[model samples]
Target: MMKQIEIRYATDADAVSLSKLIQRTILASNSKDYSHESLDLLCSIYGPEQVAERIKNEHILLCFEGVNPIGAAGLRGDYLRSVFVEPFHQGQGLGKLLVGEIEEIARQKSVSCLMVHSSITARRFYRALGFNVVKYQSSPEGPTILMSKSLS
Candidate 1:
């Protein structure tokens, strides 16, 4: 039998689990492309408190397999942020599903474009979803690819 899955807006109560999920995904998937210090810095920025603040300020979505949070993504204005999936669940199209949902939400809000600060690990994935590179940038968290997609 297929497992049940749900995607919905996240609540403040989900902060801890979301934080853990994001941090774990970063360490597992982004470690090869980012420095250890960068990973640590990114992880620190996603601690439970920060995640809670984001949930309150951004349109954050979480995907659950049964009751376990398996994926997450955030939409702040026209910007996409903090997209992550559980390492074991990667490559299974959950990321695409999350982004599609975000796009739909953006459309409902009259947003014509979506932008993402894509990590090196996620550049290809964003490109596959029709986001074109705007430029490359460096930050304390590490190198980032600025990408955008037209909703038009």
Candidate 2:
């Protein structure tokens, strides 16, 4: 039997779990492409409190497999603030699922375009999802690729 997957709007109660999920996903999946200093900065950006706040103020979503969170994504205004999947869940299409959902949410909000500052490890993934590179940018976490997709 296959496990059922569910995606839903994240709540403040999900902050700790989501934070841990994001941190684990970054450390496990992006470590090869990002330096330790960059990883530390990325991990610090989504601490539990910060995640809770984002969930409250932004449209953040989480994906669950049998009551355990396996992936998450956040949208702030027209921008894709974050996307992460558990290392074990990578390549299972969960990332695509989250992105699809985010696009739908943006559509509902009448957002014409959605943007993302994708980590180098995820640039190809976003590109495969129809996002085009806008530019290369630097963040405190280090270099990032700016990508966007039109919702119209």
Candidate 3:
């Protein structure tokens, strides 16, 4: 049988682990969509300090299997700020689970729509999840896809 994945809000103490997860996920999964310098920039932005601040400022959720986190996501207002599932943990619906959980939270708050600035690597994933691309922008980390899903 497959292990169960639990979802929960992130706490301050999870900053280091979460940051590491993000870094590893980005490096492993996004290298195809981003250059080395872009990956480095992403790693720097999602480091421990930033993770801690996000934990304090955003609604961040973690997916765990037997006390080990395999995925994480962040929401600020109606925007999905960041989402990452560990490399080994990908392709198991963890990313979809995270998005669903956050969308439910937004619905509870009466949010009319959900938005995300998706990494190029994740654009197809978001599109598969019912988000439409609004535009594209060049960033230090390569191209960013702006997407939105209506909750209504």
**Candidate 1 vs candidate 2, TM-score winner:** 1
Per-residue lDDT over 1-152 for candidate 3, one digit per residue giving the tens place of the 0 to 100 score = 45987889999999999999999998999999898999999999999999999999999999998877789987899899779999987888889999999999889989899999999889889999999999999987788989999999
TM-scores for all candidates: the values are: 0.98, 0.96, 0.96
lDDT of 2 by residue, 12-45 (tens): 8899999999999889989999999999998898
lDDT of 1 by residue, 1-152 (tens): 33778989999889999999999999999999999999999999999999999999999999999877999999999999989999999888999999999999999999999999999999999999999999999999999999999999
Please give the range of 10 consecutive residues that has the lowest summed lDDT in model 2: 1-10
Q: After superposition, how far is residue 147 of candidate 3 from its true place, in Å?
A: 0.4
Clashes of 3: 0
Q: Give model 3 RMSD, 1 decimal.
A: 0.9
Q: Candidate 3: lDDT over CA atoms? A: 0.91
**Winning candidate number (TM-score):** 1
Worst 10 residues of 1 by lDDT: 1-10
Cα RMSD (angstroms) for every candidate in the order listed: 0.9, 1.1, 0.9
The numbered model that scores best in lDDT is 1
Clash count for candidate 2 is: 0
Instruction: Give Cα-based local distance difference scores for all models.
Output: 0.94, 0.90, 0.91
Clash count for each candidate, listed in order shown? 0, 0, 0
